[model samples]
Target: MSCWDTIADYGLRSLGYGERLLPRSDFTLCQQVVLIGSGMLWNIYFGTLALIAGFVMATAVAMGKAARNPVIAKISAWFIFIFRGSPLFIQFFFAYFLFLSLKNAVPFFTVLTSAWAGALVVLFLNTAAYSGEIFYGALQSVPKGEAEAADAYGFGGWKKFRKITWPTMLRLAWPAYTNEAIFLFHATTLVFFSGFPAQSQRGDALYYANYFADKTFNPFVPYPVLAGYFILLTLVIIGLFGLINRRLNRHLPQERRSRMQMRMPVLR
Candidate 1:
C-alpha cells in the first residue's frame, strides 16, 4: 500500500476506528509512523485528563497541607509522602490489582478495572501529590511582605486570599509546575506497560512501538519514531506553558520576572 493508503488505514487504528488487524509482515516506514502516531491519541487522552483533574486536586491538597488544623495538615502530608515516596511503577501494579478486587466485590467499580479508568486514576493521584507539594512550598514561600500589605489594605479571609495570596502563590509555583506538567505527559507511556491491560489491543504509542520492535527484531527504527513523537510533544508543552509563564509574570519588569527553566529531576 502507498503511504497515503497506510495513513487512511491505520491513522486511527489505536482508537479502533480503522483496520483492526496490525500489519504482520513486510512492514513499511509509513505503517510504523502512522500507526504509532495513531496510538498517540491515547497518550494525549491520559495526560490531558489526568493533568486537568490533578490541578484542582493539587490546589486542595496544598491548602490542606498548609492548614492551621493539625489533623488536616497531617493527612495532607501523609498523602504526599505515600505517593511521592513509592516508585510509580509499583503504584500502577498495586492499583490495577486493587481495582480488580474492588470490581469483583462492587459492580460499580467494574469500569475502574480497565486501563482507561484505572490507569487514569493512578496518574491523577500521582501528579496531584507531586504538584501539591510544589504548591505548598510556593504557598509558604509567598513573601511575608505581600501578606502584610494585604492586611494593611484591610483585606482578610476569602477576599484577601483570592486577590492577593492565590495569585502570588501561582506566580511563585508556576515554573516548577510547568516541569511537573511535562513529566506527567511523559508518564502516560507507563499506563499500558503497567498491570492494566490495553483494551482490545488498542494501546498507546509505546505499545505500538514495542510491537513493531518485536516483529522486526529491530529496535532502532520504531523506538526512535516513538521518541521523535514524544520530543515533538514535549516541545508543544513547553511552548504552551511558556505563554502562561509570561502571562503570570507580565506585571513585573522583565529582569525581575521568574523565567522558566526546564530542569530534569535528578531522580523521579
Candidate 2:
C-alpha cells in the first residue's frame, strides 16, 4: 500500500478504527510509524489519567505523612514505603492478580483484570506514591520562617497549610514532580508487558513496536522510532511542566527563582 494508504489504515488503528489486522509481513516504515503513533494513544490515555488522579491523591498522602497524628502518619508512611519500595513492574503484576482473585467476591472489581481499569488503578496508585514522597520531602523542607510567620499571623492548622504551606511545598516539589511525571508516562509502557492483557490488540506504543521487532527480527527500525516518539513526548511534558514551574515560583524575585534542571531531584 502507498504511504498515505498505510497511514490512513493504521493511523487510528490503536483506537479500533481503520485496519483491524496489523501488517503481518513486508513491514514498511510508514506502517511502523503510523501504527506505533496510533498506539501512543494508550500511553497518553494512561499517563494523563494517572498523573491527574495521582496528583490529587499525592497531595493528600503528603499531608498524611506530615500530619502530627501517629495513625495518619504511619498509614501514609506505610503506603509510601510499600509502593515506593517495590518495583512498579511487580506492582502491575501483583495488582492484576489481586484484582482477579477478588473479582468473585467483589463483582465490581472484575473490570480490574483488563488494561483499562486495572492498569489505570495500578498506575494511579504507583505514581501517587512516588509523587507523594516528593511532596512530603518538599513539605518538610518548607522554610521554618514561613511556619513561624503563619503562627504570628494566627494562621493555624488547615489555614496555615492552605494559605502558606501548600504553595511553598508545591514550589519546592515542582521540579521533582516534573521528573516523576515523565517517569510515570514512560512507565505506562510496562502495563501490557506486566499481567494486563491488551484485549482487542489495543496496546500502547511500545506494544506495537515490540510486535514489529518480533515479526521482522529487526530491532533497528521499530525501537528507534519508539525512542523518537518518547523523546518528543518527554519534551512536551517538560515544556508543560516548565510553564507550571514558572507560575509556581512567579511570586519570588527573579534572582530568587530557581531554574529547573533536567536531572532528577534528590528524593531524600
Candidate 3:
C-alpha cells in the first residue's frame, strides 16, 4: 500500500480504529512510521492526563507536607516517600496485581484492571509524589520576605496564600516542575512493559516499535523512529513549559527571572 493508504489504515490502529491486523511481512517504512505514530496517541493520553491530575494532587500533597499539623505532615511525607523511593517498574507490577485482585472482589474495579485506567493511576501517583516534593521544596524556599510583605499588607490565610504564597511558590518550583513534566511523558513508555496488557492490540509507541523490531529482527529502524517521536514530544513539552515559565516570571526583570534549564536526572 502507498504511504497515504498506510496512514489511513493504521493512523489510529492503536486506538482500535481502522485495520485490526498488524502487518506481518514486507514491512515498509511508511507502515512502521504510521503505526508507531498511531501508538504515540496512547503515550500522549497517559502523559497528558496523568500530568494534569498529578499537578493538583501534588500541590495539595505539598501543602500537606508543609502543614502545621504533624499528623497531616507525616502522612504526606510517607505518601511521597513510598511512591518516590520505589522503582516505578515495580510499582506497575504490584499495582496491576492489586487492581486485578480488587477487580475480582469488586466489579466496580473491573475498569481499573485495564492499562488505560490502571496504568494511568500508577503514573498519576508517581508524578504526584515527585512533584509534591518539588513543590514542598519551593514552598520552603519561598522567601521569608515575601511572607512578611504579605503580613504587612494584612493578607492572611487562603487569601494570602492565593495572592502571594501560591504564585511565588509556583514561580520558584516551575523550572524543576518542567523537568518533571518531561520525565513524566518519557515514563509513559513504561506502560508497555507494565503488567497491564494492551487490549485489542492497541498499545503505545514503544509497543508498535517493539513489534516491528521483533518481526523484522532489525532493531535499528523502528527503535530510532520511536526515539525520534519522543524527541519531538520532548521539544513540544519544553516549548509549552517555557511559555508558562516566562509567564510566571513576567513581573520580574529579564535578568532576574529564573530561566528554565533542562537537567536530566542521573537516576530516578
Badly placed stretches (over 4 Å) of model 2 are 265-268
TM-scores for all predictions: 0.97, 0.96, 0.98
Clashes of each: 0, 0, 0
Count clashing residue pairs in model 1: 0
lDDT of each: 0.92, 0.92, 0.93
In the range 1-268, model 2's lDDT, one tens digit per residue, is 6999998888888888898898998889999999999989999999999999999999999999998999999999999999999988999999989998999898998888889889999899988999999999999999999999999989998899888999999998998899999999899999999999988887899999999999999999999999999999999999999999999889889998899988885432
Q: Which 10 consecutive positions of candidate 2 have the poorest summed lDDT?
A: 259-268
lDDT of 2 at 141: 94
Best-performing candidate as measured by TM-score: 3
Model 1 lDDT per residue over 218-245, tens place = 9999999999999999999989989988
lDDT of 1 at 156: 100
Task: Find the 10 residues in a row with the least total lDDT in model 1.
Answer: 259-268
37 Cα displacement, candidate 2 (Å):
0.6
Write the residue-wise lDDT of candidate 3 on 64-171 in tens digits.
999999999999999999999999999999999999898888998999889999999999999999999999999999999999999999999999999999999999
Candidate 1, residue 249: lDDT: 84
